[model samples]
Target chain A: MTTFQPLDIVRTSATVTTAPPAGRDVEVAKLIDVSKCIGCKACQSACLEWNDLREPVGTNLGVYDNPHDLTPNTWTLMRFTEWENPQSGNLEWLIRKDGCMHCEDPGCLKACPAPGAIVQYANCIVDFQHDACIGCGYCEKGCPFNIPRVSRIDNKAYKCSLCSDRLAIGQQPACAKACPTHAIMFGTKTEMLAQAEKNIGVLKTRGYSKAGLYNPPGVSGTHVMYVLHHADQPQLYAGLADNPSISPLVEAWKGIGKYAGMAVIGATALIGAFHYLVRGPNKVSAHDEDEAKRLAEAPK
Target chain B: MNDKAPSGAPVRVPRYSGSARINHWIMAIAFVILLLSGLSLFHPALFFLSGIFGGGAMVRWLHPWAGVVFALGFLMLFIRFLPANLPELTDFKWLAKIRYVVSGRDEFLPEVGKYNAGQKLVFWSQAALVPIMVVSGFALWTPGLDFLQSTFGIKATMDHRRLAAVVHAAAAVTTIVIWIVHVYAAIWVRGTLSAMIRGSVTGGWGWRHHRRWLKREVADGHVKSG
Candidate 1:
């Protein structure tokens, strides 16, 4: 995958200090309405075909989800969750298309050590430059969603680029384009948010009183929004974290913890050098040699 | 090798065996490689070190594997030296006069054994931290251990892996600092490096630094005339 330098990146991994020049690039988003989705795997197939990825076909383990969970080759997946609504006495099939959330505050970008390995564009799409990835899997550690995958074959990190290639040419993501029920909506962030609100209102009239958009604020809001019927209970949808934030451990590790480590290493070396200079090498003196000889030659 | 003994010179006691010296060097070399590669992946400023390992991809591939080798070598070293490096009551006396040791004023210090308090501390610290490196390294190697999810029912979640990465990096930084002290101490105590390099130390060097050890070696009739 080659970048055309088309992205006007606002933030980059491991180079957080330098801010990119301010630009007027409108943010884009993909909204998936969980209430409308029928558990069709068309989006997953479209993702595979468009990305040109050959994720190995595998047998199912008691579920409709094939190839089960996400992998390096599988960028987008249709996650199926069978939820039983206790109050309504109905079995609701909650199908969510799981992929990179493309957060405004991308934890993957924050945790990545390799420069240019992960980048966030002005349009709010988080992308991984595989060529620059060391495959150390820091991005995996950084991601709250656990999105990035490290491949053993190339030893490079990978994740959903939000179809950055297609978007560069004014085309929507393959998954959104292939949606049969128009469950997945793609447009400018503003337009998508408006559309999601309108859809949620219609869902409210249809008895989904709690229907709302899920643009999690913990990540400062993701470009990928979810219009959920049971929005208050996101965990009902296959352990989709109700309050996903970058792990505090990751924040410390990538934040002050990084500098503290550097300081400790630096201080140790400097102290060693200073000690060597101030207090010279301790050499064995002639008295010590004489003492050793006397001891060795002593009568037993 | 630098300090060749003259004819009828002072007897030299065996400090390390040839095989032990080889093991030490292997561990040392592997440690350096791991430090460079790990640090390269640690921060952007040192990422250039990835060049030494061929590239970022290669470093990523090699670091944890190299860690395995280092860990194995360290395990051998730990076992071999454990009896000697075990803390004794006299080690406290040695620790009490740490100032004298650092300032090269050993007259105030206690008669030392095969290893000093400092060496024992290094041994124990590494013993404690090496396991952390291995366990955390395994957790971070996501693609390599995806099988665990199915086989052992270990869900390698992002938060779990994230915690592991932090612990791994933190432990590595600590190990590197400890190693710096170990290397510096070996050099500052003039004849020490040669023990790992040549597998022996001059009787005089041993008597001055580790008098009790030299006495024991001589009493055991293992001393060789230089």
Candidate 2:
């Protein structure tokens, strides 16, 4: 595991660290070519082994997806979707690796309230610091992709890190290294985009005309890009969001709402102080005391 | 009716029962705790306040529990004070003369019951806001969510939690503002704090601020003995 330097962090949650690192790190990306994938769980196993995570065997729920949905222990899973091509009238089993997209403008980092709990490195790897996590699960709410899962045992959120530790030591992510067919590629984002373009060209000649790249610009494009055979209908692969962006509610809560709330609270306190300073305390007059004495003696 | 001072001084009229005072203080203490913990998480500037509760993790752990305590205490307070805080015809008159009330010109205001319009507003607003804060707070609570999922098979989705977070924060901000107003009102009205503290106010205080209440109490023979 590589220990990141403070300067490597481009953004830190709930902090005002805006100074960019003196030396810029090369932006990296993980490109998963859905067309080349064979629905093998080799990358999943490699991820589990590399991250030292042991997810309990779950009962098969009439699907090939093992362990069902993503858990805190299972950072990566291969989601298999069976699509019947209407025009071709043939069954197509579409397999996509499901994990954090690691967006350029990560929503998790935006919604995290604890200082330094979520950080985005200059290389665009969004990482979580478990010790700083408050178990609020705000990140899960902020995520457009719904990738983060908080652990029930320790109450800390866990998700795909994009293998920042491996990247730091000049090694690709474990999943990429374990890909038997080179379906999962890792390199600079520039290289991955070019590779995706070449793959799209090859796919077009092979009659998959809808093949394109899935680097959603809604989140300023993701560090994890995908070369989808039907990028126009990405959701057909398993409910993948078509135009994912941070929820406006999350944006409001973390953005203008925060500043405006503080302002309103401050104004309330200030108004109270101003009122006290101007009007002073309302004291009972001596005649009121006389009336009270007279009333108590005569009343009833 | 009044309690005579030990040195034969002015008499005091009872305003609150001992139990009522205890309940109010419990709610008040819980509100303060919730305020501090909630603020620490609300913004980065106030994050240092988390140290008071040991750290961010502890603050997260303690805030919701404090909220539960506060809600329970507030429920008791609400029941005890509801009758007193109920809107009266004179309350509208008092609200109409709110300018005079704020300017400390009480002579221009109508005689009020145990709670004036401002006090009633505080009471009712909190009554409305506390439940919202509590319900939304539970939605954002991870342990509570996990428990619901594991035990009851009730899953709160990400959108539900997100909406809850926004609602909780909005309600909390309103509650805190109302709390400040409530506290300021208590301080601004001289001798008012005694009602909650010593469970009574000077006979003059009762006659001056809540004259209608004082007259009814004396007429009903509910005065405390010296």
Candidate 3:
């Protein structure tokens, strides 16, 4: 039996660096192994606890998945996929942690209307602050993983931040640390890539032909990497996009629309006010003023 | 269509009841709140508006309830207004030439009864969206009704929220635009707000703005004096 390091048992304050200089490069992360995960959901719970995210309590959807999917409250999730293997004549269950991949060209970052709602941290973890986020679906539309889920209460956008606070404090993410089998690991992107390649080679020797790493090329490479056992492609995962690309239309109109709408209404109002002020007495017809005075004096 | 007082006495017809006004304003306020909150949450970048509900979590918690409140308010209006909003054969007669009302050409507008073609369009379209949003909103809120909801907890998803959102927002946009037109018409012809606010308009307002309706009300004995 493996021990849960349980960060709280020997609790200490996070010794985090306040800031990284402009020229300092972001250290990216990678964590996953297809064969080892038993789909145990300790990672999900730990993530919620570490981040001060609310505990999810609700009816389960097919698996032990509760609260069903990611929401404003729950940012990280484990996706379960089942497939029939062509080579092995047996079925297999594939589990991948479904959260913000913290892509190099982050879609949520691109689509955010606020300046700092979804942001990159030292570990290339995507972070969110409730105060900054608008629940616009532009991030939902732009993401290849379809990671940004809108909260029902205020319609604000929400998704994984890769447990940014942990990285800041010089600690492994709650998800990776709680993962019993080391199925989820965290490290520099380069080291993680090296380990992923080696793991695939070992699986190849073990005669798993379809085994491969997955990080869609067009997504600017997700910080969270995956190794999969497949009878098919990576798109088999839940929430995977058919085609992923940034919407030029959104890019063009996003900021411009708000200002444009304000300007139109403001200009119209100003002109109307101008007309009223400049042409007030003239605009009021002689018949109208006489009738108004008569009604005012005649009325009780 | 004459602006002259009726031969017998005068004209006084109630336009909107107190219940109708109450329902209308409630729906309007709720719709505006929902729209602002929804816009703030639509994109991570737009997250700045979360402050409207105090912050992000508050927005997340309150958005659904706001939707529920807005829908219920609209339901009250629908229950009260549906009968009047029905498409009468005569309604279509006025539809083709509604532009005349806006063009300052009083003579060209059709012999509109209580509501002109423009008003009729706003009323019916707004009424239609209430039920659509209520049904869609429920399906969206209750998690287990659809299998996708069962699998992904997508019940409260942006997909669901946005569907109702589009309808909710579209209805609001149409309503507000119509409101602008309505205000312009009232001022253009005179005394429109007086009837709604004070429950009476000058004889000139009723005759010039709703001539056909005024004539019928007087003939049917629904009006006597203002």
Best by lDDT: 2
List the candidate 3 regions with Cα displacement exceeding 4 Å. A1-24, A36-84, A90-95, A105-115, A131-160, A174-183, A235-300, B1-13, B31-70, B82-93, B135-172
Residue A140's lDDT in candidate 1: 80
TM-score of each: 0.94, 0.96, 0.68
Q: Give the better candidate number (1 or 3) by DockQ.
A: 1
Chain A TM-score per candidate? 0.94, 0.97, 0.72
Tens-place lDDT digits, model 1, residues A68-125? 8888989888888888899999998888888999999999998988888888887889
DockQ of each: 0.55, 0.52, 0.12
In DockQ, how does model 2 score against the reference complex?
Answer: 0.52
Off by over 4 Å in 1: A1-7, A16-19, B1-8, B142-156
Better of 1 and 2 by TM-score: 2
Residue A168 displacement (Å), model 3: 2.1
lDDT of 1 by residue, B99-218 (tens): 898899878889999988998999999999999998788888754356556677777666677788889989989999999999998989988887987888888898899999999988
lDDT of 3 by residue, B3-50 (tens): 432343233456677777777667667777766666565433445577
Q: How much is the lDDT of residue A213 in candidate 2?
A: 98
Q: What tens digits encode model 3's per-residue C-alpha lDDT throughout A1-300?
A: 002112211111111122333442456676688677887888888888877788546876667556577777777777787767666777878676777777766756655555445555544555555565545454674565667777767656777666655665677888899999988888888888888888888888888887777765676677888876542366666545534555444333343544454455446556545644543421223333333323333423
Fnat, model 2, is 0.64
Top DockQ: which candidate number? 1
Best first by DockQ, ranked: 1, 2, 3
